[model samples]
Target chain A: MKAQRIASLTFTALAIAYLAGAFFIKEPPLRQQLGPDAFPKTIGVMMLVLSLLYVRIEFQRQPVKEDDERAAIIGAEEKLSDYVDYKTIGIMLALMLGYGLAFESLGYPLATFLMFMAGIYVLDLKHWKRDLIIAIIASFGIYFLFRYALRVNLPIGVLKFLFR
Target chain B: MDIWNNIVLGFSVAVTPFNLFLAFVGVFLGTVIGVLPGIGPMTGIALLIPITFGLPPNSAIILMAGIYYGAMYGGSTTSILVNAPGESSSVVTCIDGFEMAKKGRAGPALAAAAIGSFIAGTFATIMLMILGPAIAQFALNFGPPEYFALMFAGLTVVTSLAGRSLVKALLATTIGLAISTIGIDLQSGVSRYTFGNLEMLDGLEFLVVAIGLFALSEVLANLADMRQAVMERLSIKGGLWLTKEDWKRAIPAFIRGTLSGFFVGGLAGAGAAVASFVSYGIEKSTGKHKEELGHGAIEGVAGPEAANNAAAGGAMIHLLCLGIPGSGTTAIMLGALLMLGLQPGPLLFQQQPDFVWGLIASMYIGNVMLLVLNLPLVGMWVKILDIPLYLLVLFIILFSFLGVYTVNNSVQDLLLMVGFGIIGYILRRLDIPAAPIILAMVLGDLMEQALRQSLIISDGSLGIFVTRPISLILLILAAISITNPYWGQLGAFFRRIFGQKTAA
Candidate 1:
C-alpha cells in the first residue's frame, strides 16, 4: 500500500483504539457532569472523524484508472520512504532504549560509552578505535559536568567503589 | 513616572556585567547555530536550554530571547549562502538572496538582511515595550470566564492559521488537551490516565516532551537523508552600502515589513514564518519593481529578513504580557519559565518588575550585539557551518538526553523522550503539523483550570462564557478567527457567481 493510505489507516486504527480504551476508564463515584472522561471522549471522536476524512480525501484523489495510477504514486512514495534508513534507525532506537534502562545499573559513563559506540557503528561509521576514545571522553566529560559543575547527581552504580 | 522608573529598574538589571555577558554568549551562539542548515532558532533554543538550567529566571529568559533574534538574523545567512533556510521563517529570503549571491552581490544582500533585521528588531522591541505593559494592564481586569475565553480564542486562531487543514489542527489540539488530562485531575483530584503507575501520578514534565518532540525528532528526520549543506567558499567582501536605487526600494519595504511582521507575529500562533510569507506577498503587490522580485531584488531580502526578526521580537510581547505564548518557540519559553517557578501573566509585571524590565532591556542590547556579532564575524559563522551533520546529530541527541534527565532526573524521562521522538517522527511522516500539538500542550492546564473554575462559578452553566462581556468578545473573535482559513475559498465561490451576474 502507498504510505498515504497506510498513514490514513493507521490514524483510523489509533482513533478507534483510543476510544475503546476510553470506555474502560472508571470514573470517580458521582463525578461532575463534565467529568474527567469528557475531554478524552471528545478527542477520541474528533480523531476518528479527522482520520476518516483524511482516508476519504486519499481515496477521492485516485482516478478510475486506479491500478496504474496507484502503482505510479506508490513508486514515488516508496522512493521517498526508502530515505528513512530503517535498519539504522531501528538499531539507534533500540540502543537508546537499552541505554536508558542500563543507565541506573551500569552507570552514566559506562552506559553512554557503550551506547555511543553502538550508535556510531549502527550509523555505518567504521573508525571504531577513534569512536571508542571519543565515546569514553564524552561519557566521562558529560558525567562530570552534570555531577560537579551543574550540581546534578548521576548514579555511579558499581563504579562508586573505584571512584571513592 | 511609572514607565520611566520601570525602564530605569530594567536597565539596571540588564546592564549588570554578568547579565551583559549572558546576552553576549546567547547572541554569539545563537548566530552560529542559526547559520547551520536545517537548524533554526527553535531547535537551537531547545538544544541549549540545559545551559540555562542553573541560572535565575531573568538572565535565562534574556539569554533565550537573544538566541531567538540572533537565530532570526542567522537564518538569512544560510538562505544567501547555500539557498537553504535554516528555518521556515527565513524561507522567503532564499528566493532573491541566493540569486543575488550567484550574481556576486552576496555582500550587499547579507548586509541588507542584517541591517534591516537590526532596525526591525529595534522597532519591534519598542512596540513590545509599549504593548506588553498595556496588554497586561488590560488583562488584569479579566475574570475566570474571560481567561477561559481568551485561551479558547488562542487555540481557535492557532487552529485556523497554523495547520494546513483545520480538521488536522483540531485533532492535534484535542490530542494535546487529552494528554494534559493524564495525571490527577486538577479539580476532582482523580487520576484520569495514570493507569495505576507511581511514575504517572505526578504528570509528564513539559521539558521532557519538548526535548523529545522538537530536538530528538528533528535529528531522526535529518538523519534519514543526512544531506549536509554543501557551501561554496566565497569572500563576503563587498561594499555594505545599498545602491541609491536599492535603498529607494528597500527602505519602504523595511518600514512596511517591520509593521506587518510585528502585528502578525504578535497575534496568537502566527509567528515569523507566517509574518515573512505575508510580508513577501505584500512587498510584491506594493512594488512597481514587482518584475525585479524573483531576479535578485534587494527588497526581497530586506523585507523578509526584517519581518522575520521583527516577528521574533513581536512573539515575545504576547508571551510576557498575557502568559499565552504567541508562537511555538514562545510556548517552549513559557514551559521554561514555568520550570523556573515563575508565572508570566498580568501579575508578573506587578510582582517582578525587575525581571520583566530587565528582559525588555536585554532585548535592546541583544539586537545591537547581534549586529556587531554578525557583521564582523561572517567568516567565523561560515566556518561553524562546516561541522558534519552526523557529528551534530550525535551532539543533538546527547544534549537532549542531558536536558530531559536534568528536568526529571528519571531514566524513565529519557525513555519517554525517545518514545516521543519516534512518535514525533511518525507524525512528521504523516504530514501532521507539530506546532499545534505543542501549543495546545502548553496551554492545556491553564485552559482546563479556567474552564472548571468558570463552571463552578456558574454551577456548571456553559452560558457563563457568553454572559461576561470580555468572554463574549473573545468568543466572538474566535468565531471570526476561523474565517481566516476559508476566507479565500469563500471569496472565490462568491466571485464566480457574482461575475456571471455582472457579465449578463
Candidate 2:
C-alpha cells in the first residue's frame, strides 16, 4: 500500500522507457558491426532482467531484515511521515534552482544573499540577525573573490551602477 | 640508489616557491577540515578541487596530495581531544586517545601521534618512491584489451569489497556506465543518448556529477538530522616531550603499523580505515601492554595513527601507478586529473615524471608541515569544531554550487548536479556503494574504447581478448574477483555436504 517495491519497479519503468526511446533513436548507417544504440539496448535489457530478478527474490524472502540498508528499497513502504525531513531537502533544492534561474537577472549578490538566507532558515538556524549579516557578508565576499580575484564577469542585476 | 636522481628532480619541482606555498595552504586547509566534526578529508578534497582549476596540473596535484595525507595527521587531533573521530580512518584512535585525554595525558598522546605519523609518512613515501616506478614500468607492456580486463577486474573487486549487497553495487556501476554513454560517440561521431537537446550533446560534466553525487547528497541526508554536539574542551597543559617509556613502547608499534598499512593500502580496494583496524588488531595481539589494550594504552594511539598516515601514503601508489583510485578521495583526485586533460596511467609516469615525482616529494614536506602546525597552532585548529553545523552545511552547499557554476557557467550543470545528488542520496539509502559508480563513470569510455579496439584489431573476432596472454590473465583475475565474494557461501555449502556425508 505504501512505497514498497519502488526501486525494482522504478528500474523496470526506466528500462522500458529507455527501450522505447531506443526504438526512436536514429543512427547514421555504419560499416562496423555494433551500432550506437546497441550498447544502450543491451544495457537496458540487462537492467530490466536484473530488476525483475531482484523483485522476484525480494518477494520470495519473507520477514525482511530491518538492519539491512537494502530494506530502504522496499521498507520505505510505511506512512508518509516516515520520510525524514525530506521537505527541507525539497524546499532547499527548489531554492537552489530558483537561485540559478534568477542569478543573471537578480545579480550574484542579490541571488546569493537570498539563497543563503533561505538555506539558513530551512536548516533551522534561528538567529535572524546573525543569519542576515552572515548572508550579506558571504554573498559579497564570494562576489568580490570571483570578480576581482578570479576575474570572472558576474551579473549585476538591477544594481549595476554601483560597480560602475 | 637509482631513486636518488628522481628524488632530486622531485625536490627541484616541489621546492618552487609557488608550489611550496600551495602545499602549505593545502595542508592548512586539510588540517582544519580534518579537525572539524562532520567534514572529513573526502569532503575537504571534493570541496577544494574546483579551487585548483586556475593552477597548473603539477601544482594542482601537489596541493591535492598535500590535503590527502595532511588529513591523516590532523584526524588524530579530534580523536584525542574530543573523542570524536574526524574521519573513518581515525575511529580506532578515539578508543585509546580519549581515555588518555581523560587521564590528563593529552600532551604526550598528541606528541606520540605526531611523531608516529611523521615516521610512518616518511617510510611510506620512501616505499612509494621505490615501488611506484617499478609497477608503472610493468604496466607499460599492457595494451588496450589488457587495460580493459584489468579495469574490469578492479571495478568488480572494488564493488564487491565495498558494500553488503552485491546487486545494488553492480547496479550502481551499470548505471554509471550507462551515464557515460551519453553525448556523441567519440569513435564513430554517432550520437547515442542526446535526446535531441543540444545541452545533452556534451553529456554530463564529471565535476558536476561528482559534486552532486558526493557533496550535494551528503548535505540533503544530514539536513534531517541536524543537532548540536557540544564537545567538552580538552587542554594540552604539559610539555610535549615523550617519556623514555612512551618512546620505547611507541616505536615498534609505529614500525609494525607502517608496514601493515603500506601493503594493505597498496592493494586494489583495501583502504586506510581497514589498514588502521588491522594495525590496531595486530598491536593488541602482539604488544607488551596486552592488559592495557583499551584503557589509554599508548600503542593503541601510536599504531593506528601511524597506520592512518602510512595508509594515505600507500594509497597514492595506485593513483600514481595504475590510475585506479583505492578510495573516494583518490577518485576525486582522478576526476581532477581528467578535468586537467591528463590521463593517469603508466604513460603518465613516462610522460610526466616531474609531476609524479614532485607529488611524491610534497608528501614528505606536507607531513612535516602538519606535525609543525598541529603542535603549535592546536588551539586555533580545535576552534573550527565549534562552528555551528548549520552554517557549515550552508557553506558546503553554497560552495559546491559556486564551484560547479563557475566550471562551465552553465545552469543546466547545476540542475544536473542536484539531480545526481538526489540519486546519490537514494543510492546511499539503498546501501548501493557510490565508489563503484564513480569508478565506472571514469572508466566507462575507456573501457568501451578498449573493447572496440580489441575487436577491430582481431577483425571482429572477440577471441582477441582471450588470445593475448596478459588479457587472458586479467580476464581470469576478473572472473576470480566476481567469485571472491561468494567464496564464504560456497565454503559453507561444501562443509554442509561433507558433514552430512560423515553423519551418514
Candidate 3:
C-alpha cells in the first residue's frame, strides 16, 4: 500500500511538471493545422487525471498486513524486504552503469570481459578457472562476431596498438 | 484464381535457398529462445532486430515471423518437463503436460502438442491466405477519420486488457504518447523536447526501448528474485507416438482450439495468452473427458498448445491487412517493418505483392520445419535448460548493450536503455504492465498523424469523427472498451433502482 501511494504521488508530480513544460513550448512562426504543443498538452491532462484516479483507488483499497495470506503461504510473517534481494540488484545495476561508461574508453573486449567477471562474482560463482574461461570466450567471441562477421565499427580504444 | 497466383508467387520467393536457410535459422533460434525461461517471443524478436538490419526487407520479416510462430511450438517443452511455462501463453499447458510427464506418459503428451500445433498452424495460414486480400480491399477505403478511429480503438482495447488497474494502464499509455511527442514536430519542423542533446532529436529508438523494457528488465527482476530452477530429468518411456484413444480425444480439441484462437487473436488486444486460456476453458466445459483435464489428459495440453500457435498466425492478419498490430510482438514487427522502409497496409498488397506473399508462404514451410525440429530433437532442446542462469543473464545484458550501440553508436542511447530498464523494473514491481507502453509508443505517432489529418480535412471540427458511419462505429467500440470493467457495477445499480420502484 505504501509503495502504491508513493508511485501515485511520484506520477502526480511528473504530470504537473510535464503540463507546465508543455505550456512553455514555443509557437512556430508559420501557422499550421495543429500546434506542436497540442498533443503534449492533451497527454499531460490525461496523465494528471489518471494519476489522481490511481491515488483515489489506492486509498480506497484495504492495506494488506504483514501477516496476511501471502505470509501464511510461506509459513512465516514476511516483509517486502524479505522477498527482494536489493544487494544483488544494486550490483547488477552498478555493473551495467560502469560498462556503459567504459564501453568506448576501455574498448569492447576489455569492458565486456570486466562486466562478465563482475557479474560472475556478484552471483557468487566460486569456480574461478571455469569462470575465467567463460568470461574470456564470451567477451571476445561477441566482439569478433560484431566486429568482423557483422562489420560493425566497434571502438578499439586502448587496444588500438594490438589491432594495428 | 488470384489467391492461387499470389500463393505461387509467395512460394517462388520462399523456395529460394537464401530465404529457406533464413527461415530455418529463424525457427531454430526461436525454439531455443522459447525453450529458455525468462525470454518470451517479444524479447526474442527485439534482441534479433539488429542482426536483421543487413538483410533484405522480405527476408528480414520472414525471419522475424518465423520466430513468432516457432516460439509457440517450443514453449510447450518447458511446461511439460519442468512444470514451468517457457512463456505466458504456455501456462495452461503445465497443468496436464507436467502431470502426464510424471505419470510416464511424456512421449504421447509431447507428440500431441507437436502434432496439434502443426495442424493449427497450417489451418490458420490457409485462413490467412483466404481472408487477407478481402480485408485489405475493404480497408483500402478508409480515410483519415476512419484510420484515426480504428487506431484509437486499438489503443483503448489494449489499455483496457493490460494490467489490473485501469488508471495505471492509462498512465502507462499517456507516458508512451508523451515520449513519442519528443524530437522535432513533423508538421511545423520545430523541436519540442530535445533538451539540447543531438541524440534525443531522433526521439529515442524503438529497439532501444523494446530491449530495455522486455529483455533488460526481465534480467533485473530475475536477479532480484534469484529463484533457482531445479530441473528434474524425465525420459520418454514409450515411443513418440500418440495412442488411438489419445488421437480420438485430441483431434476435436485441436479444431476447437484453433477456431477459437484464430478469431480471438484477431481482436486488437487479445493475444495468444488469452486465446490459450479461452481454449482451456472451452475444453473444460465441452470435451469428452472433461473430468480428466488436469489428470494427465492429452486434450488439456493439445488445446492450449494449438491455440497459441494458431494465435500467432491470426495476429499476422491484422498486421498485414490493416497495418495495426494485435499484440506486443507484432507491434515490434511493425516497428521493424517501418525501419526496413516497408509500409504494411492495403496498398502494400498491390505495391509489394511478392514480399507479402513470400512471408505468407514461408509460414507454411516454417511450421513443417518446427514439427520436425520439435519432435525428434526434443532431447537437444531440453539440454538448453542445463545452461547456468547467471550466464544467461550476463549474456542478455551484453546483447542489450550491443543492440542499442549498434543502432547509432551512441552511448547516450545505452544510458537511456538502462534508464528504461530501471523504469520497467519499477513498473513490474507495481503490477503495471510494460507491454501497453510499447504498444502505445508504436501506435502513438501514427495515431497522432491520423488525428491531425482528420482535423485538417474536417476544418478543425471534432464532429467529423462521428459524422462518418465507420468512424462513429469504431469510436463507439473504443468507448465500450474503456468502460468495459464497470459494466458489472452499472448493472447492479440499475437493477436496484428498478426493484425499489416496483416495491414502492
Candidate 4:
C-alpha cells in the first residue's frame, strides 16, 4: 500500500476498533444511567468521524509528479509505520511482560534488574559487560532509593517469605 | 503593599537553606539539560517532578521555575558556540550569533545576550508582580466557550510555528488529540482507549513521551551523524566587553525586541519563537547597520535574546491568570501544579495568596541567580560537551526511569513510560512537531470539561457560548485571529500585483 493509503486505512481501522469495543461492552440498567461503555461509545463516534475525515483528506490529495516533488520526501522512504524499530519494540514488550509476571514473584530489585538489562540489550547498546553492570547497579540503586529512602513499601512478592 | 508583603514572605520562604541549595542545583542541572542537544525545558522539569515530592511545594516551584528560565539562558550558549540550538527558541539566534563567534566576536555576542536577558527578565518579573492579580481577575470570566475559542486561536497560530507543511502540523495535532483520548473519560467514568489494560486507564504520561520524543530521538539523530561532538577553541581572546558603537546600535534593537516580545508573550497563543522571529525581522528592517546582520551584528544577538526572554515572561501571564499554558514548557509546569494538588485559576489568586506571590517573587530571584550563574559559568557549560556521550545517556536514562517509577512506586507506570517512549520515537521519525501534541494532550481534558459544563449551564443549548459577553468577544477575536493570517498573505499578493501593474 502507498504511505498515504496506509495512514488513512490505519486511522480507519482504529475508528472501527473503537466502535466495535463500544458495541461489545454490555449496557447497564437505566437506574445506573452511566456505565463503563457510555464514554467509549461517545469517543468511538468521535474517532469514527475523525478517521473518516483523515481518509477523505488522504484520498483527495493529488499525488505530485515525480519531477515537481520536493526533495524532503524523495529519499525518505520510511513513513510512520516504518520508523517503529520493531526489534526493539518486540523486546521491550517482552521485558514489560516479564516484569509484570515477576512483579509479585521475584520482587522489585530482581525484576527491575532483569527489565533494565533486557531494555539496554533491546535498545542495542554495544558494550555488553558495561551495559549489563551499569543496568544492574542502576536498577538496584533505584529499588533501594524508592523502597528505603522514600519509605514507599514496594511489593516483595514471594521474596517476602525469604526476608522474614 | 500586598505584593511587597508577599515578596518579603517569599524571601523568608526561599531563604531556607534546603530551598536555596535546590534553586542553585536546579539552574545548574537545567543548564546541563538545555545544553544537551535534545533535552528541552519540558523534559528538564518533568524529569525533576518526582524529586519534588520530597520538598515543600513552594521550594519545588521555585526550583522548577529556575529550571524553566535557566534552560533558556543555557540554550544560547550552545547556539553561540556551536551552530546547533539546544532549544527551539534559540534556533534564530544561531544565524547571526554563530557568525559572531566565527569572527572572534563571541565574547560580545554572549555578553549582549546575557545582559539583554537579565534586563528583560527583571522587567518582566516586575510586570508579573503588578499585572498578575489584575489579569487573574479578568481571567475569572473565562468559560467553556472562551477556552475553546482561545485553544482554537492557539492551534491556528501553530501554523506559524516555523515548520513546513501545514497539513503535517494539523496531522500532529490530530494525533495528539487521539493520544489524549487514551485515558478513562472523566465525565461518564468509562475507559475510552485503554485497550483492556488497567494501566492504560491513566493514559501515557506526558513526561515519558517528551523524553522519548525530544531526548531519545535527538540522540538517535545525533548518532546517525558520524561526526564527533562539535566543540571549538574557547577563551576570552580580548577583554570581554562590548564596544561603544556596538552599545549604541544594540540599545534600540533591545528596546524594540522587548516591547514586541512582551506583547506577544502576554497574548494567549504567542510565544518566544514568534517573538524572536518578529524581533529579528524588525531589527533587519529598521537597523542602521543592516549590512552587519548576517555577518556578526551585535544588535542581532541583543534583539532576539531580549525578545525571547520577554516572551518567556509574557507566556507566564496566561499560565498565571487563566491557568492556560501558552507553550509546552508551561504545560509541564501546569502538570507539576496538578501533581502538587494545586488548582491554578483566579480562585487560586484569592485563595492561595502566598503560593501565587511567592512564585512571582521567586521569578525575580531566579533571574538574578541565572545572570550570576551564567556569566562566570559559561566556561563550565562549554566544558560539558566534553563529557562522554555513553555516560551522559546512561545517567539521563537512569534518572528519567527512576523519576517515573518513584512517582507512584508503580511497575505499571514504568511500562507506560516505555510505551510513551516508543510512541515518542515513532512521532519523531515522522517529523511531527512534538510540542503541539503534548500541549493539546494536556489541555484536552480541560477543554472537554469546560465544554460539558457550559452545555449543562445552557440546558443543552450550544448558544450559551456566544450568549455571554466575554464568550462573544473571545469568539470574535478567534475569528479575526484566524482570518488575520490569510489577510496578511492577501496584502502581500496585492502589493505584488500593484508593483507589477505600475511598472508595466
Candidate 5:
C-alpha cells in the first residue's frame, strides 16, 4: 500500500512536469491540425488523471490483515533487503557504469577484463584464481569473436600495439 | 495453387545452406537460453540482436523466430528435471513433469513433452500458412482510423492483462508512449522533446530499452535473490519411447492443447504462459485420467508443452498478418522487423513473400531440430544448468552491455540503458509490469502516426474514429478491455440495482 502511494505520487509529479514541457513546445509556423505537442499533451493529461485516480484507490483500499484469507493467498509482501543483497548490487552498478565510461578509452580488452574481475570478486570472493581465469578468457574471447567473426570494430585503446 | 507455389518458394529459401545453418544455430542458442532460468525468449532475442546487424533481414528474422519457438520446446527440460520452470510457460509442466521424474518415468515424460511440442508446432504452423494470407488480405482494407483503433485496442488488452494493478500498467504504457514521442516528429519535421541531445533526436532505440528493461532488470532481480540452484541427479532409466497407453492418453490432450493454445495465443496479450495454464486447466477437467494429473499423468506434461510451443506459432499470426504483436517477445520481434527496415503489415506479405514464407517453412524444420536435440541430447542440455550462477550473471551483464554498445557505439546510449535499467529495477520492486512498456513503445510511433493520419482524413473531426464500423468495433473492444478489472464490481452493482427494483 505504501509502495503504491509513493508510486502514485511520483507519477503525479512526472505528469505535471510532462504537461509543463508539453505546454512549452513551440508551435510550428505551419502547424498541422494535430501538432507535435498534441499527442504528448493528451498523454500527459491522461497520466495525470490516472495518477490521481491511483492515489484515491490506494487510499480507499482496506489493508490486508495477517489472518485474512486474502493475505494467505497473496502472501506477505517481501522487503527488498530480505531477498536482495544491496551491497552486491551497488557494487555491480558502479562497475557497469565505470565499464561503460572506460570502454572506449581503456578499450574493450582492458575494460572488460577489469569489469569481469571486479564483478566476479564482488559476487564470489572465495574463488580468486577461478575468477581471474574467467576474466581473462571471457574478455579476450569476446574480443576476438567480435573483432574477427562478427567484424565489429572495438576500440583498440591500449591494445593498439598488438595490431602494429 | 498459389498457396502451393508460395510454399515451394518458401521451402526453396529455407533449404538454402546458409538459412538452414542459421535456423539450427538459433534453435540451439534458444534451447540453451530456455534451459537456463532467468533469461527468457524476450531477453534472449534482445541480447542477440547485435549479431543480426550484418545479416539480411530475412535471415535475421528467421533466426530470431527459431529462437522464439525453440525456447518453448526447451522450457520443459528444467521443469521436468529440477521442478524449476526454465520459462514461465512451462510452470504447469513442473506439476506433473517433476512428479513423473520422481516416479522414475522421466524418460517417457520428457518424450511426451517433445513429441507433443513437435505435433503442436507443426499444426500451428500449418494453421498460420492457411490463415496468414487471408488475414493479411482482410487487414489490407484497414484505413488509418481502423488501424489506430486496432492498435489502441491491442495496447489496452496488453495493459489490462499485464499486471494485478490496471493503473500501474497503464502508467507504464503512458511512459512508453511518452518516451516514443521524444524524437523529431516526422510528420511536421518539428522537434518534440530531444532536449538538445542529438541521440534523443533519433528517439530511444526500442532495442536498447528492451535490453535494459528485460535483460538488465532481470539480472538485477536475480542478483537480489541470489542462491545456488541445486539440481538432484535424476537418471532417465527407461528408453524415451512412450507406451501405447501413454500415447492414447496424450494424443487427445495434445489435440486439445494445440487447438486451445493456437486460438488463445492469437488474442492480443494472451501468450504461451496463459495458453499453457489454460491447457492445463482443460486437461485437468477433461482428460481421460484427470485424477492422475498432478500425481504423474503424461497428459499433464503433454498438454501444456504442446500449448506453449503452439502458442509461439500462434503469436506469429498476429505479428505477420496484422503488424501487431501478441506478446512481449513478438513485440520485440516487431521492433526487429522495423529495425530491419521491413514493415510487417499487409504489404509485407505482398512485398516480402519469401521472407514470410521462409520463416513459416523454417518453423517446421526447426521443430524437427528441437525434437532431435531434446530427445538424444537431453543430457547435454541438462549439464548447462550446472554452470555457476555468478558466472552466468556476469556474462549476461557483459553481453547486454556489448549488445547495447554495438548499436551506436555511443557511451551516452550505454548510460541511457543503465538509467532505464535502474528504472526497470524500481518498477519491478513496485510490482509494475515492464512488458507493457515495451509493447507500447514499439507500437507508439505507429499509433500516433495512424491517429494523426485519421484526423487529417477526417479534417480534425473526432467523429472519424466512431464513424467507421471497424474502427468503432475496435474502440468498443478497447473500452471492454479497460473496464475488464471492474467487471465484477460492475456486475455486483447491476445486480443490486435490479434486485432493489424487483423488491420494490
Candidate 6:
C-alpha cells in the first residue's frame, strides 16, 4: 500500500514536470530548431513514459496489506516523554525564530549572546550563570571573528543606541 | 620543462596562506558534517559553495575540494563510533568498525582506517599527479553524443544500485530533470515551470534542492523516530593506537583494497560505495579471518577504508578529465564550479591550468592535514555529537535560513527553501533516491547546452559521437556493463572457457 502511494506520487510529480516543460517553452529558429524547450520536453516525455510504465508494473503486483498493528507499534515506540527532549522540533523552531527576530534588532554581540543563551537553554542547560557568561563570550568572539577578522557584513542591528 | 614549471606555479598558488587556511576550513567543516548521519560530502560542500562565492575562484575551489576530502575522513567516524554511516561509502565500515567498537577494539579499528586511508590517498594522489593531463587529453575528444551517452550510462548504473525499484529511481531522475526546467530557459531566456512565480524564473538552485532533500528530510525522518536515535552507546573506550597483530592483518588488505577500488571506482563510476562493498567482499572471501569477517575482523575495517579513500581519489578522475562528476559529492562540487561561471572539461585544464592543478595539489596537502586533524580530534567530534539535538537542529536550520537569505537578502528564497524542504520530506517518505535527481539536475543544463552546440557544429548530424574513437569505446563499455548481468549463462560459458569459476 505504501509502495503504491509512493508510485502515484512519483507519477504526479512527473506529470507536473511534463506540464511545466511543455507549457513554458517556446519555439526556436530553423537554424536552432531544438530551442530551449527541446531538452525539457524530452525529459518530460521520458518521465511521462516512465511513470506510465511504473503504474502498469506496480498495479499488476499484489497490493500490499496495510497493517494497523504495524502503525500502532511504530506510534507506541514514539513515547511522548521521548518527544519532549531538547531535540524536540518545537524548541528548535522557537529558538530559530527568536534568533532570526533578535539578530538584526539587537546587534551581533547582544543578539548572538541571546541566541546562544536560548540555544543552551533549549538544550536544558542547568548552569544558568555559566551559560550566560559563556554565551556572551562566545557570541562576542564569533562576532569579532566574522566582522573584524573575516570582514563579513554582519548586521549591526537597531541596538546601536544602547551600546553607544 | 614546461610541465614542471606549471607544477611549480600551481604549488606556489596553492600554498598561499589564505588558500591553505581555506583548504583547512573546508576539510574541517566537511569532516564534522560527514560525521552526522544522513549528511554527506554533497551537503557539506553545497553549504560551503555560497560561502566561497565571494572569494576568488581558486580559493573557492580549494575550499570546496577540502570539504570533499574532509567529508571522506569524517564519514568513517560515525561508522566506527555509532554504527551509522552518513554516506554510502562509509556503510561497509559500520560492519567491522562498529563490531570492533562493541568489543572494545575501537582504537585499533580507527587506527587501521586512518593508516589505510593515508596509504591509499597518498598513492592515488601520486597517480593523479602523473596521469591527470593524459586523461584530460583523452577526455577532450568526447563530443555531445558521447557526453550524453556517458551521462545516460551513469544514470543507469546509479539506478541499478539504488537498492529499490529501478523504475522509481528513473522516475525520480525524470522528475529532477523536470524540476531543472522550472525557470527561464538559458538559451531563449523564456520562462519554464514558474507557475507564474517570478522566483521560479531563475529556476531552482541545485543547492536549495540538495539541502532540502538531504538535510531537511533527514531531520524530519529522524524526528519521527527520535527515540531509537537519542543515544547509542555514548562513550567509546580503547587506546588510539594499533597493536602489532592489527597492523600485520590490515596491511595486505589495505594494498589490495587500494588497487581494486582505484580500478573499479575509476572506470565503473560507481564511486566509493561500490569500492567499499567490493573490498569488504574480497577481504571476506580471501583473508585469513574469513570466519571473523562480521565479528570484528581488522581486515574488514582496513580494506573498506582503503577502498573508500582510494575511490575518493579515483572519483576525481571523471571530474578533472571529463568534467563529469562520478559521485554525488563531486556533483555538488561541479555545481559550485558552474556557479563560478567556469565550465569544467579539457578546456578547463587548458584555460585554467593553474586553477585546476592548484586544486589538485591542495587535495594532497588537505589529506595530510585531515589525517593529523582526525587522529587527535576524535574526542572533539564525539562531544559534538553529544550536543543537544534540538540545539543542533536549531542551529542548522537557522544558519541555513540566514545563509540563503543573506545571499540575496530576499524572503522569496527563504520561502522557496521551505517549500523545497517539504518536497524533500515527501520524496524521502517515498524512498526515492535523491542522489540521481540532483545529478540529473546538475548536469542537465550543461548537457543540453553541449548537445545544441555540437549539433550546430555538425550541421545536425548525429554521427559525431559515433565517429569519435574515444566516445565509441565508452559507449561500447556502457553497453557491455548493462548487458553483462542479464546474460548469466553466456557469462558462465565465457568464464569456463577462461578456466574461471562462478561464485554461488
lDDT of model number 5 = 0.86
Evaluated on the second chain alone, the candidates' TM-scores are 0.95, 0.94, 0.98, 0.91, 0.97, 0.91
TM-score-best of 2 and 4: 2
Cα deviation of B226 in candidate 3 (Å)? 1.5
Tens-digit lDDT track of model 1 for B178-200: 67767777767777677798788
lDDT of 1 at B8: 92
Better of 2 and 5 by DockQ: 5
Q: Where does candidate 6 stray beyond 4 Å?
A: A6-10, A20-24, A29-31, A62-149, A152-164, B1-4, B234-238, B461-464, B467-469, B476-504
Query: What does the lDDT read for residue A21 in candidate 3?
Result: 83
- Residue B32's lDDT in candidate 6: 85
Q: Cα miss at B258, model 3 (Å)?
A: 0.2
Error of 6 at A125 (Å): 7.8
**lDDT by residue (tens digit), candidate 5, B252-307:** 99999898888875544467877888899899898878999999999999999998
Residue B39 displacement in candidate 3 (angstroms): 0.3
Residue-wise C-alpha lDDT for candidate 6, range A39-120, written one tens digit per residue:
7768877787777767776666663332223222111111112232334555544554555566566665676677677666
Give a tens-digit lDDT track for model 4, residues A30-119. Answer: 323334464456656766775676567568766433212221211111222232344444544565556655764677667767766766
lDDT by residue for model 6 (B1-504), tens: 767876787888889999999989988898888777656777667666668867888999889878877787888888888887767788888888999999998888888888888888877777876788888887787767778767766656655444345566778777777777678877777777787887778888777777666666555555545645655753568688888888889999999889888877655676787788889989989998889998999999999889888888887877777788787778878887887877787777888889888987788888899889888778788766765554555445645655665566555665566567657755665655677888878877766777777677778776776787766676676676555444766877788877744443
Model 3 residue B204 distance off true place after TM-score fit, in angstroms: 1.3
lDDT of 2 by residue, B360-411 (tens): 8888888788889988777787788777777877888778878888778878
Q: Tell me which residue pairs clash in candidate 5.
A: none
Point to the candidate with the largest DockQ: 5
Better of 2 and 6 by lDDT: 2
Error of 5 at B153 (Å): 1.4
Which of the two, 1 or 6, has more lDDT? 1
Report the C-alpha lDDT of model 1 over A36-83, residue by residue, as the tens digit. Answer: 666667778877898898788667766234323422311111112445
Q: How well is each residue in A1-164 modelled by candidate 3, as lDDT tens digits?
A: 78889999999999998888889888989876778888889999999999998888778866534224322221110122337888899989989999998889998889999999989988957776888998888788777877888888787668889778
